[model samples]
Target: MGRVEPSLFSSTSDPGIDQANRPDPRAFWVVTFAFVLTVTSFGKYEISRLTPLFFYPVTIGTLYGVSARALLRKAFFALPFVLLVGLFNPLLDRQVLLEIGGYSLSGGWVSFFSITMRSMLAVTSAILLAMTTPFDRLCLGLEKMRVPRVLVTQLQFLHRYMFLLRGEALRMVRAHDLRAQGNKPRIALSTAGSMIGLLLLRALDRATRVHRAMLVRGFDGEVRVLHPLRFSWSRDGGFALGWILYFVLVRLVNLPEWLFGWVVGR
Candidate 1:
């Protein structure tokens, strides 16, 4: 049978074996933490400097068998919010900072561009993290890295149970569709509120039963993984160290300028 597509919030869509060749989730977590820290550390107008940081997401995507196009497409959904946040930058900071090809560039526009680039990098990093690591493994990694147990447990439960909530919603919508009047199938605003209330009650009832089932199955508030994670020094350590070194180098060096000068024999 073909692979069954999962719900939006469901993360175990694919088998964990798919990530076999991938680095340990904890290693990915470390690098992601460092990557975000480095990307956001750049100044407001340092968009050019941030270009090299794109290498992290691109490289990680490639390594994890995710295409650059897919990563960018996923990251694109977050840009509108970022744009909204930076919308007033150009209007408020009109002081010209430089001229490029006779076109004056204001500090506001420069900062706006910088903000957008940073946001894209950050979002891309996060998307890559989610793409490469399964939700269960990610929570395990977080717990290993000293993240609070309560938070990790909550996240685990949220991811595991979101599919149940989605199924309940889908059933309700389907039932509504079957009962509604002919042709244009739509939920009336008047009925939507009641439907939502009904969904909430159904969700609570479902959650209670699921919790009882889990308790019967020996769920003692501890998340369990089918395949326990083991940190490999040669593999995981090398992967993290290599990326960390590259990030540090990129942060301290003007790579584009250096490449240009080298090409020109300067």
Candidate 2:
């Protein structure tokens, strides 16, 4: 699963649309599966062949109401690790595959490019799914899709508490800064290490308190959603079929090549 950098609680521009706006969360699931399958099929193609395929999701995501800026920013989350993974490819794969004038390019560079493009496409589409569907609702959707209760339950709790732990850590940092030298503020490396341990201790204490409170109120380790999961054959079924068909067509035909050919056939 890809991580998104945006705030989960931030509302989109259209307040009228939300996780429950559509009758079925499966609509999003269908779209996700189609996109993933399409990307996977591109594995057999090289850089030039797969380049345009990657951009298709960007267009789809934008049409689905995800802003271009958000897509790019979220896509960048996987970039550093992707860069690290491909860093040695150019060095190790030195077989010259292309020559332009005096400059020669190796297979390593081509493979690295392909890897980077795939990474960006995968991460961006995953982020788009998150942006379109609320996390809790997605978990419920997963549960509906027969995903294991334990996995969904853990994911729900982790998402719920990440913010709590972040807030606590920030408060600790603020207090430490206040007590330190104002003009030339700096913490000793040993002190910094101790603060990290202190942060974990504080997080644990907070978690225990929250758990006790939940138990006092009769929490049975189940997070409940207020709305019922609705499914309509007319809406959700057609929606699923439409997007899945589009993905299938794109997978079978080189859409970019076809479109280019169509444009030039005057």
Best by TM-score: 1
Query: lDDT per prediction?
Result: 0.83, 0.72
Candidate 1 C-alpha error for residue 89, in Å: 0.9
Residue 4's lDDT within candidate 1 is 18
- Tens-place lDDT per residue, model 2, 75-159, is 7778999788788889998899889899988989887887787767767767777776667667888888988888988887777
Worst 10 residues of 1 by lDDT: 1-10
Winning model by lDDT: 1
Number of clashes in every candidate structure? 0, 0
Residue-level lDDT tens digits of model 1 in 1-266? 11212212575746634667778999998898899899888898887788888888777766666767776777789989999989999999999998999999999999999999998888888887887677777888898889999999998778766777788999999999999998879999989999999988898899899899989999998867777788999999999999999999999999988888899995
| Residue pairs with clashing backbones, model 2 | none
Give the distance in Å from residue 164's predicted Cα in candidate 2 to where it truly belongs: 1.8
- Give the root-mean-square deviation of each candidate in angstroms: 2.7, 3.9
